[model samples]
Target: MQTHYEQEERFRLAKKRVDELKGFYGNLVSYIVVNLGLMILNLMTSPEHLWFFWPMFGWGVGVLFHAMKVYGFTPFFGKDWEERKIRQFMEEEKKRNESFKGE
Candidate 1:
């Protein structure tokens, strides 16, 4: 039911999605490993001061956003929202073009 181009396009989109997932997972793993190391170092050097949580919290926030974006947890700016906006813009453009052609 689909053309070669359509199949290829679907494959490309799927591959891109997989790549995004891989990137998010890689970022998460790095965050965990680095934060764990920092926590241990902080505990070993300055257990009283306790500064590891700062970096951990900041990086954790970044990772959370990354995961949200990759997982499409963004309610307002998700794929559906984007597609709708794109269609809206295209309709507006088409109307404008038709008006110009009529003139």
Candidate 2:
């Protein structure tokens, strides 16, 4: 059973995660709305240059990164890395304990 503090910490973490998800969703909605407006403005004014793609690309990159962060999809130092580190340390500790027993 978790202590009261542990439960509170878990709740806090959950709330933080929820907030991150909410923020990402908000960003996505804004990106869509703003880009649509930009596209319309571009089409109405300068159909030849098509400068709308620039902001779309830049903000697309931002949205991608925001999604990655909110979803914890890091290419490096993610859950896989954490699990590998835990296993490595556990193995090392087991070896040390065995050596101690031999001594």
**Residue by residue across 1-103, what tens digits does model 2's lDDT show?**
8999999999999999999999999999999999999999999999998999999999999999999988899998788999999999999999999999999
lDDT of 1 by residue, 1-103 (tens): 9999999999999999999999999999999999999999999999999999999999999999999999889987998999999999999999999999999
Query: Candidate 2 regions off by >4 Å?
Result: 79-103
Single out the weakest 10-residue window by summed lDDT for candidate 2.
69-78
lDDT scores of the candidates, listed in order? 0.96, 0.96
The candidate that achieves the highest TM-score relative to the unseen native structure: 1
- For model 2, how many clashes? 0
The TM-score obtained by model 2 is: 0.73
Instruction: Write down the TM-score of every candidate.
Output: 0.83, 0.73
